[model samples]
Target: MKTLIVEDSATLCAIYSQYLDGSGLEVTSVETLADAKAALVDWHPHLVLLDIELPDGNGLDLLNETVNLSSPPAVVVMTGHGEAHAEQAIQLGAADFLTKPFDASRLRVTLLNAAEKLTLSQQVETLAVKREYLGPLMGSSSAMQSVYETVESLAGTLATAFIMGESGTGKELAARAIHQLSARAPGPFIVVDCASLATDQLERALFGTDGEVAQGLVAQAAEGTLFLDEVCSLGFASQATLLRLIQHGTYRPVGSAAEATADVRIIASTNRDPLFEMREGRLREDLYYRLHVVPLRMPAMRERSDDILMLAKDFLDRIAHEEEKDAHNLSDPGAQALRGYSWPGNVRQLENTMRQLLLTSTSTEIDESAIHQVISVNEISVGNAMRSRPSQLAESAMEPSTIQPLWMTEKKTIEEAIAACDGSINRAAQYLEVAPSTIYRKLQSWKAQNLNV
Candidate 1:
């Protein structure tokens, strides 16, 4: 480790320097506060041995300045014998005190312990910052509180987690919370999309190649977390590979004989039921068992009726802040419309709608007209509307489309698929297991019906 010795006495500075150097620590000695500050900013030492009195200024003043440091090195104050000086050093967050003429062994032990504590404290602060940045999952409902509790409980453990939720319900966010809370918080948190990559590409990404040696998400998340989204879509071969990794914590690169051990915790997320997938032969039962250690289910927006308005306002504020525009206050009618709407697209869809409204609305206050425009343009059904908690909704009838019924069955099916995919058109089509062309054809046909203004 590196050490800095700051003392006004030139003899003591030199003596401590020689002792620290002999102990295999790189040491820099400075006699004045100015030189000490310069060395601290430039050298970034692991520990400091600071004298209480300085020729230019009291070392306590220097200690006060060091606390502003982004990553402050530990300070061990050296005082001449006054109780006042020792008390001041302790108040200023000095790691420990060394009386003048202290033994070399005592100084070394104190420095070593302080350095270790400093490292641990820094790690804890980093994790706290990460959790704060991620924000709470944004719900006031009991179900959401329960979900939050589960996430908090799992965050410190190494157990594999399986998250089951509709699309746009924040599965990845929950996985991140778990990783940040876990013992491996310092390591990387890697994400893998099982549905996005082709089977061959997926295998290559997960298992890696011989010549190039790609660090598969699992390998990259060594001593951390690997989050698998849309895991139910993984092909049998990939599923088997994943199962092996979960079971044995060992995997070989695509063509290598040497097996590497993975210390990663697996967090798999899927909109589909893993049990259903397994029963249908789409997912292996053994793999399902391996991944389903702790199951966390996120409630749908409809289920958390009380939190609808809060979520809406939160989204509106976020959008307005991002755009650098005045946030629009929702009038009672507008608030009612939001609460009444089924929100088939869930939180993500609500966020996007708020952004669109903020962009389109000319007035500072969002009124019923603006809400109706969003609903009409988006073609949300009235039957699915006005169903949330009374605290959220303003009771009023939305005009039904006067247009003749046109493939109502197909529209219902599309809506179902969209909801199943968490509002992803592509994934919705995939769930229908139909060609993209077919979805496009049906959408075009529905638009041609020219539903009322």
Candidate 2:
């Protein structure tokens, strides 16, 4: 530990220097308060062995400054005067107070104890700063940067936001990023997957049971964020309950008599079109509007194509570090194949592919062949096939065996593209080989038809 002895008496300072030096501690001695202040400003010592009675000023003056300063070092005050001064020093944030003419044995033990406390304090503050932010959402691409900024801007506001993206698009991670940046970051971040739970199970999970005073999903997420994934799959009754909670901020347990208030920021996600669900009346229109206050449409991997290799490298490095092995760099052909192939599963698929390569490959450099083995076109197709809901395939296949007019089919294709890209009109137009204005016109026409429907 680095120790600073602020004693005006030259003899006493020399004695302190000799004793602390022999004890294997780096010691610096200053005879006046001015030199002490200079040392404190320049080299922040781990422990300040301050003498209260300095030549120019009392050490008590520096105590207030030390305690009040940001990143203050610990102080261990010493006095050659009365007990009153010792008590005063302890009151002003002194970790320990020692009287003059103290034995070296006691001073050594006290300084050691003070050093431990200081080390632990620094460690705790570092961890606190780290926990204040969630995991790195690694992407510097304009598309990803926009997503980051949107989450940051909306984090402080207590409004519901709906995030729509395909599976493996990191919806939950996005939700967590929002919460980490939010004012209620210290509160619970509860995630409820509507698609994973049965109707009865979802009901019990969201709105706790009768005998137990169930803290519904909203209640459990009070003053925090509630992430409801695959919200379109929520049963009709649960949808109604969730709608009531969002609208009125009030809900009751499934079988309870007591009504509870919900003060939560609901962030809902779905792979399917919430509008389609609303159109079919499977998802209530009112609930849709309530949760869609600030709809954040997460772009699919194809839309954010620039970030493909960057994300792949990031995941690869993470896996390497986790396995305690040197990082495997991607070859040119490997990178080319990564960017060329469509990541239908988005970021999640890329992460899995990186892990698979790390597990299977023995070489330090990952080549295109290794990548192809892990991320085949057929493998991706199979993944997409598995992700497709029965209704989604049925809707796609049952879209009139009799072909519609070319213009009408083209319009429908653009609409589907827009939905697939999470409402990016520019991407939709690019996918359709048309101008953005044309996409807007088609969207307007679709809206008109929706009104009629």
Candidate 3:
């Protein structure tokens, strides 16, 4: 601890030096209030031991300044007269007060206690500052810095933002971060999965159905954020409805005569290129401009090679805790392998792989073999995706000889990928270029059919 002693009497100051001797604290002494103020301007001691009777001014004056300063130091006031001022000093933000003719034995213990409190207080302040930048997010790389800057800029506004990134690059996380930081953080944040919304029922889901007025996600999300995930998948009719919603603050549900006002902040995300969507007429150009008011492009995992192990280790530790496993971290070789291998599926794939390792590998440290196994599975998926010729699955699906349900073909292909990956659904999902949820839902449907998945 850094302590400043403000005492005018030279003999008393010497006595204080003797009491504080060998206490492992850096001590500085000043005799007058003017010198004390000068020292305070730059010294910024953690604890100030002040004598009320100073040469030029009362120690209470300096105490008041210390209390009101932006980053104030702890104060312990002393007086040669009486102990009555102790109560008054504490009410003015002094940590504690002491009378002159101080007890030498008690002085050491008093300073030590104050030092401990100062240390803990500084630690809490530091944690609060760090959390403002990285509470839900991890990794302190430059790639993440840019994202943080954009998040900060958009957090206080009501602009409709579009977060663009590859699948599993944490687009939803970015959207949630914006909502959590915004002024509307306390209000509801509803996510409408545009890709999953049925075309025939999207209007009802967003605006509302006929009977129930509050059936719409937008109406429910009033005064908060409405997140549209995979918005590029929305059909033209849905796109037109959404454009109208953005252009005007009012939206009328299906079969409703009155138009209800919905004050909502829109945040949308898509893995597909938004420009391509506009060019192909999938996404309305006017709606694109509205959402493009604030554009956030998340850096892919491979692009942020600096954050690979950081993210990997974080996932490992969390998985270990949840599963009650003793595996604490990744080995140096494992970390190196992770950085070297190209992550075709980004953060989500890495997280899923870590979960798999914690569940399957008994070794405390995730070794290089586990890393290679996961990467090799992803590599196979990329190879298969690349080898599929132009028109991709369309060319094969239209074969007259097959004459089978398209879903059966898709199920067979997905199952083969899972079997090939030795029953790892995450790796299979990566190979099939779909969300893990899609794979899980498909397996559930197959299970209902009494068919092996």
Candidate 4:
């Protein structure tokens, strides 16, 4: 944990420093907003103990600046008895406030609790950034067989790969196959969705911010693959930073002055044509060539129509077992209907159709009626997309949806735990092996909806 104290009184800074001494946290003190901002450039602290009044300006102005950061540090404001700005400080995202003259113990406790929340939030975000590569590639088409052969050949090489494919073409599965067959299989296989991030959050998501050096995908994939999905959606700055990591194997974190070496291999994927991306100013020319080594293009399902029945049968078998249905194989008309329809969504669409068929059927074989109910057999049947909610499908496929909002389940479970622990929030958190602050935060959020413990 690290803290930066912003105060004009040198004597108070000394007192705070002594109180934090030998507490296993690094502390830095600044007397003005300018010095505090300068320290933030290189010294990214996890928490800030800010004073309401600084020699140069008011600290709330500084709070406004920091609050707009992508990964802002926690702020704890200090105000005098009559000059307390508690409500304003809270509105500006001050984690906690202290009315002067607060004892050193109170300051230490408040900062420590805020530090715990900050650290836990970072950990959750880091865990959410990773993707688990669990299975082998699932096609046996001639085109797919060729892709697998190429993957086998490049499995041991350390060179970067650029995976090219349209959406739903299993580009990510191909990336996983390469990783699992390579020497770095034992390490992590991390994914960063370039298009999903806002420009302000992209740098920190990839390279981390000033204080969170190890929170980026690159660091998390230390000896493994950092798969950049839709790589061209990345901003110019992120692309340049990625190019630096590839060219020099070093990158500077978002606000850090120093550069660190990266050992992760880059595997970038994009649905757009690489040439078109570079020509339109979305992808840089220099970076494209560096990532263009060992290109692997995934074949769209439309190009391999012969594999449609095989893929559908495989999906049916899995879905049958999962749903405990009697469906075992497709009838002749069922197979013809599947092969004739143009799959605009590719293999993913076929798999989803199979699952729906399996859910709707109770017979040993899938009939033509069940197939036509979900998939349109006529050429002009447009706008009736197949990816409907599972529970909201045709009457035959009335199985309960297995997917539900995770937070609802979590809220129910936590509320039950609190009741089981005799309404002791701390005891409930301890039973769940989580920090008490997590429950408190969730409860506070739920209170807005008139939820009671």
Candidate 5:
């Protein structure tokens, strides 16, 4: 670890440097805030021993700046003002504060604690970058990395986590990950599909009726996890009962007078916007707050397009093994097609597409034609479903007179490349000699403008 000591007194600096010697930290000493700022940029220390008072300025100012760095150093504020500015220093993000007359032992212990925290934080970051799979969840994108970190952090605690995402975005999988990684891994993981049951049925299923021989889902999930999928679909009555259970950790079975203690961890999920659902009275506001202790949002497939092919290949390999068929490799064009489409149905849809290809395709290598055959069928099904519903088709229809020539030409070129590569922005960007982010930005702009790109 790199350590920066910001103190004006050369004698004190020498003492502190000697104290930290052989402590495995590369130390750098600066006397003023100006020099400290320069050292912060060039040296990029992992830990900082900051003095509250400096020759040029207050060390709290430097501490504030250091904490705002992209990968900020742990700042231990050292001051001679005793408790006068201790509160202010801490408020500015000081890792530890030491009074002027502190001994070497006090300073070392504080630095060690701060250093330990920094080590753990760096390890979590490293794991996020390298880990491609967390239980059933698999992705290497920045979005998925964040999800992985959150899941890992939540696994050690008994906090209730509310996962919100589009349907088939693997909310259940995330719940399972939390359960499997938690201390309750040895116990059962019970799932309740709130959308599948009626209000009465849901209540009966969750909390057993009087004199029932079989235990309810909550009881079945004792000392484990109870995953409530599509929780927004739960009726108001059921939501109230759930809120009571979460708040009191006790629930009464229908027609029963006694309360049963709940030993299970609650993990709820919904495909709808929870806030919107709450406002519309579809979900209880109180219930939402109680269960929203740790909100985990699953990234949609479109948001993590970079992981499309990786997920596709994993599905293909796993499906082949299950069916006792020869493993199929995704051809470049096939991969391109997989990446291009907006996966509204998310991972579940992707997995289904792979299964369809394996069942129908006889070739060892799955190419663009095979992929398109499966995708087109899916698109047709989706189109049929959309057509059945009332839609603003006329209002959304574009007119030729509204088109801009230059924008149309650019859109056409990009569209052609995307079509040729089976809808991959990365491939199209390569053909256009532009960054993928550049194309993504333009596509977002075009979508916002309703240009139909």
Candidate 6:
């Protein structure tokens, strides 16, 4: 680990240097806060051994600044005024505090413990990046990897989780993964679809009706997880009741004068943006805050194009087995087509498309033509249905008669992404789900063609 010592005392610096000698720390010494800040930028140390009294300013000021870094170094504050500044240093996120006149053995032990913590944190992060699947969700793209890590972390706690994603993006699957990995894994996992129930019925469905002998989902999910699917769709009254349940862990059944204790862990999900719903007064702000403890956003399929073929093959294998069909592989062109299309319906739609292909195509290898046929049929069906809706008539009126060339569409999309990222090719590539090299090559090709890039 890289260690930065911010002690202004020359005698103490030499002594501390001797103490950490052969301790496997790449150490650098600075006498002032300004020099320490410069070393932080240039050397990027993993840990900082800071002294409270520097020649220029209080080292606590520097501690506060380090707290705001993107990846702040672990700080060990050393001082003579331990009683006065120890709490303040810790509050500013110091890993450990040491008083002057302390033994070298004490300093070494504290630093070693802090170093071990930093190493474990880095290992967890690296493991999260390498993970490709979490329960039913499968994707190796950075976006999905992040989701996997969050879900895994949430599993280790009882904090309420709020999952947000478009329809068919496997929001429920993510919730299931958390429950399965949690301590409540052996308990019942109940799903309550707030969107499907009537506003009046939702309260009773969740908290039970006093007159009825049957308990509601909250009771059914006792000692387990209650997944509130499309939670934003609940009525204001239901939202208020749910909020009460979350706050007090107690709920009153409809027509009941007594309250019942709930042992359920709430995992709420919504297809709509919770903030937007709050602003529009559809979702209560207080209720939103109560349930937004551990938020997880499942990325749309188009955002993780890197995992398209892998997911396609997995879906195909599972679906074919279920349907008693022969195993089939996607041709190279078919895989390319699958990756190119924007899946508005996300993973659910992709699985459906694969099923359709398996049932209709007789060939062992699904080719580009077959894939296109299935996708085109789906698009036509969606277009026809959309055209029938009165709300879409205005949008249909603006449709162009001729479709733009694929290259022109690609150029517009790539350029817009680059502009959105402030001309950062790497950021644009991430947003576009393509490699930076791909963007560079495309820009070069467009330039070579004398096309406006």
TM-score of each: 0.54, 0.55, 0.59, 0.53, 0.61, 0.61
Task: Please give, for residues 209-240, the per-residue lDDT of candidate 5 as tens digits.
Answer: 77871478988988899998888887766677
- In the range 1-453, model 4's lDDT, one tens digit per residue, is 779999999999999988887667789899999998887767877799999888889899889888887888989898884534888899888988888887878877888888888889889897555322224676656677678767776677988888998888888888888899999999999998988987667778878877898998788999999888998777766676678889998878888998888988788899889877664445777888998988888898888787888788878888878887775898899889888877888888888888877776678788778888887642234443433434343656645585446667778989999999999997887666454666776777778777543
Q: Can you tell me which runs of candidate 3 are displaced by over 4 Å?
A: 1-133, 381-453
lDDT of 1: 0.80
True-structure lDDT of candidate 5: 0.86
Query: Residue-pair clashes per candidate, as listed?
Result: 2, 3, 0, 0, 1, 0
Q: Give me the displacement of residue 153 in model 4, in angstroms.
A: 2.5
Best by lDDT: 6
For all candidates in order, the CA lDDT equals 0.80, 0.80, 0.82, 0.81, 0.86, 0.87
List, residue by residue over 132-245, the lDDT tens digit for candidate 2: 223456665666766876787778688887888899888888888888888889999999988888767876787787766435676778778889988988766667667887
For residues 275-359, write the lDDT of model 3, one tens digit per residue: 8767444566677788788899999998888888878878888888898888567888888888987776899988988888788
- Model 3 quality (TM-score): 0.59
Model 1 spans > 4 angstroms off: 1-136, 380-453
The residue ranges of model 2 lying beyond 4 angstroms of the native Cα positions read 1-135, 214-216, 377-453
Candidate 1 lDDT, 1-453, residue by residue in tens: 788899998998877776665676778889999999998888988788999788999888878988889888899999996778988898988988888777778877888788789889989886444221233477767777788778887886788899998888888888888888778889998999889887678767877877545567666777788899999998766776778888998888777888877778889999998887765456776888888888999787788777778878888898899999997889999899988888777887788788888999999899888988987877645444544445222344334554335567567877788888888887875566544445666677668886332
Clashing pairs in 6: none
Quote model 2's TM-score.
Answer: 0.55
Q: Candidate 4, TM-score vs. the true structure?
A: 0.53
